[model samples]
Target: MTVEVQLLGGTANQGRVHRVGNTVRRPLRPTSAAAHALLRHLEEVGFDGAPRVLGVDEAGREVLSYVPGQAVTAPPPCWGLTDEALRSVGRLVRRFHDATADFDPSPYQWSPQVPAPFGDGGIAHNDLNLDNVVFRGGTAIALIDFDLAGPGTPVWDVAAAARLWAPLRDPSDVTDVRRGRELHRLRQFVDAYGLDAEGRAAFLPALRDSHRWMRDIVREGAADGVPGFAAYWTAEAEARAERARAWFESAADEITNAVT
Candidate 1:
């Protein structure tokens, strides 16, 4: 019998993922079919940065090929916090966007979290949180957890990555080596991703939107009694969210200058 080893990290899937040999088993969601289709399309187009859908398990969970790499979990390892790692993430996201350029998302009902002004240019991973990215030797390799993958623009994806990876949060909240270098790192990320002038121009607004969108998701998840979200939505977390918003407003010009 194949042993089921639980995989840690990620709030939404906490206590749910298990590794059986070289496959991962995850619970099916309303959007799983669409996510699976996206994965299959990525495979069809030869995008190796995502896991391959390996069909369903006997227990009815979706099975995916195990991507062998370390995810940037809490307290983030030294390698995952380097500037090079950030750049690699930017480049990887760009590649993912390019791979989805010709995909037809019209056939799938995606997560309804996609907001306007950044409407469906292509399917985006949407949740590029640090833990979603898998890295080896400090280089980002694959993006997992496609539950939030849906209709989104390339800049939107870039902004989402920047928000989590560059982590445009308030400095008070960033206690690592990345503390004061947020905007500088954000510039490196965008440059690595090779955002065009137009994309750069739209990036700041996208960042603001991305921040609110993610905040709302976490807030809703907590309200709906999700254990991870509930645990994360403490009074301090709420205060940090407000501080992050204020920081964005005050640093808008600096952020704009950095990316431009």
Candidate 2:
């Protein structure tokens, strides 16, 4: 009944990661055929940029291929925040977008529809926090943690990625010493992704709204009994949310003009 290995690592939000022999099972997530179908479609028609579906584990957890490479955790030295790394992440994301452009929409993660005052991006890994991105050769070559993947706008995903990589945090949390350089990274990312006029135009507000939207979900997950989520709300989560919302508000014109 049992035959495998178990390893531990960080998750995008807060969850358990277990390696059972040759496969990985992410806690409290689904391994639906639809999800597998999406992964397969990405492999077949689009970019082969995602982890492989390995069915369910013995404990009925979502099983995925144990993707290799380093996840970019924070407290990074300045080099880890290099322009080249940012550009690589941007390019990889663009490739992912291009790869999945032809996907048929159905059976997605999270809600199938996004609400007003906030435009949602299409099917994507969605969470680009440093932890979810995989680095190789000093570049983010792959992505993990598709818990938030779903139907939405490329704008939302781009903005969210920009928030994490371009950062969009208050200057204080921008602690890599190369501080104040995130704007340049932001520009590089948008340029690499080739977000057009409309896409860019939609970015600023989408970015701002998405922060609150995401916080709402995280807190909701906590409220709904998702383990570990509560820890976030009680910690830097509130401060980060405040910082991001404030920064986004203050930088509204600049972000809007940049994306425009």
Top of the candidates by lDDT: 1
Candidate 2 runs further than 4 Å off: 1-15, 28-31, 77-79, 107-112, 116-121
Residue 83 in model 2: shift from native, Å? 1.1
lDDT of 2 at 224: 75
Candidate 1 lDDT, tens digit per residue, 1-260? Answer: 78999998878778999999999999999999899999998999999999999999999999999999999998789999999999999999999999999998888878866789797688788889899999999999999999889998999999889988887988999999999999999999999999999899999899999888888999999999999899998999999999999999999999999999
Write model 2 residue lDDT over 107-129, tens digit each, in one string. 45454344453433456566777
TM-scores for candidates 1 onward, in order: 0.98, 0.87
Each model's backbone clash number: 0, 9
